[model samples]
Target: MLDGILAARPRGFSLAARYVAFALLASTLNLLVQMAVMGLYHGPWALLLAMAAGTAAGLAPKFLLDKYWIFYDRAPGRLRGLRQFILYGLLSVVTTLLFWAFEITFHWLGDGGPLRYVGAALGLGLGYWAKYHLDRHMVFGRA
Candidate 1:
């Protein structure tokens, strides 16, 4: 039954699977870093600072993996790579807004407990999935 399910995946499923796997790993790291920052800091802006740090920490590896492994984009020029990174950063702003909305909403609803993390997880998952499509067509223009 497991073999049958595995065999029935459509084309590009493996690529998508790998992308999601890497995203999960990166997100986990991001969340850990964010939580650690939050723990050490004590101020009104702590969450914002932590979020920024977490996002920055995870972005580099995610970009590299998405560029080389998922999109297979090899343009062979630092200028082109910089252009791609700029585009990715633009898209990231949109996704980060989505993530922040959910996270802040949850925090407002609940007093910064597990619900906030739940919101962050949901937001990041949705953001990354949307980001994959955007990156595929807009940034990489592969598929």
Candidate 2:
């Protein structure tokens, strides 16, 4: 039964599965970075700083994994990779804003602590999901 289920997986399921796996890794890294920063600092700016730090920390690894693994975008040149990275950054700006809004709103609502981390996780999850489609269609393009 399990083998039948695995065999019946859709054409792009493997790619999506890999993407989700890598995204989870990146998201976890992002949350850890945010939590670490929050632990050391407390203030309005600290929240912003932590968000930015977490985002930056997760960006490069996510980009590499998406480019080389998920999208299979090996175009054989630095320029292509750079252009893709720029597009990724641009798309990420939109998702980052979405993440920040949710995170900030939840943080204020929860009054900080575990709830704040919960907010961050929720925000990051939503952002990464949206980003996968955007990255697939816009940044990396279909394989």
Candidate 3:
């Protein structure tokens, strides 16, 4: 579905635009998953569980979209693709820390309420921005 949309983009539609669109979609999915998880589980582990579920929900789609759309790179084989995914995960560590910092801070300050999502959104935005450059230069060899 999104692949078709990306494929049918106008000639003037820039790569940045597509990337942003994909990011927004992935972020939305992440947030939605977080909301659902938090809604379902209000136990002591609500924040932890929600964040884990949200990140898991968002990751695979983002990777596939980035691999096929943003960088337009194909994995040569199974092992190489796994290696690429692993490298991508490693590069994400720093950004993930940034996100966790914001999220945990807000969660603490706001008593684990809506403000946490605000922090998460901000963190994810910044993280995605940095992640793009990292993935471009390091993972995709497009520097």
Candidate 4:
């Protein structure tokens, strides 16, 4: 586990850079969805609904980009693809908890003007960092 996280391969840096870029793109889309939903809806569950919408918006692109570019996976088969997606979601549940925790904490401590987003970004960044190692070792069958 430690070595997986620490190993410095030749392509590791490049992959890391690309992964982060894609993660930012995904995050932006997620936040945009939340913002749009919040803009139109104002009910007791607005925040919850916005977050759910944002997460759904981000998942597909993130999964595709990660499976193809970040992980370099191009296996051909609908069943295999579905399996990978399921495994991805299973792993993501943990990271998503981290993200939600951070966002909710920030919301609680903030004045409701982007503090939660800052938290979400930070949380997602950390989650992605951990997730990279997990995917390398597990999802892509690296080692």
Top candidate on TM-score is 1
Better of 3 and 4 by lDDT: 3
Model 3 segments more than 4 A misplaced: 1-11
Q: Lowest-scoring 10 consecutive residues by lDDT in candidate 2?
A: 2-11
lDDT of model 1 at residue 110? 84
Q: lDDT for each of the candidates?
A: 0.85, 0.83, 0.84, 0.80
Ten contiguous residues minimizing lDDT sum, candidate 3: 3-12
TM-score to true structure, per model: 0.88, 0.85, 0.87, 0.85
Candidate 2 wrong stretches, greater than 4 Å? 1-13
Candidate 3 lDDT score at position 76: 70
- Clashes in model 3: which pairs? none
Give a tens-digit lDDT track for model 4, residues 15-126.
Answer: 7688889889988998899999989999898888888888878887888777777776767899998988888888888888888888888987897668989988888888
How much is the lDDT of residue 131 in candidate 2? 92
Per-residue error for 90 in candidate 3, Å, reads 2.1
Indicate whether candidate 1 or candidate 3 has the larger TM-score. 1
Assess candidate 4 and give its lDDT: 0.80
lDDT of 2 by residue, 1-143 (tens): 64353334246568768777888899899989988998899977998898899999999888887777777665778898899999999999999998888888888998865677777778878998899899889987784
**Candidate 2, after superposition: displacement of residue 81 in Å?**
0.6
- For candidate 1, the C-alpha RMSD (Å) to the true structure equals 6.6
Worst 10 residues of 1 by lDDT: 2-11
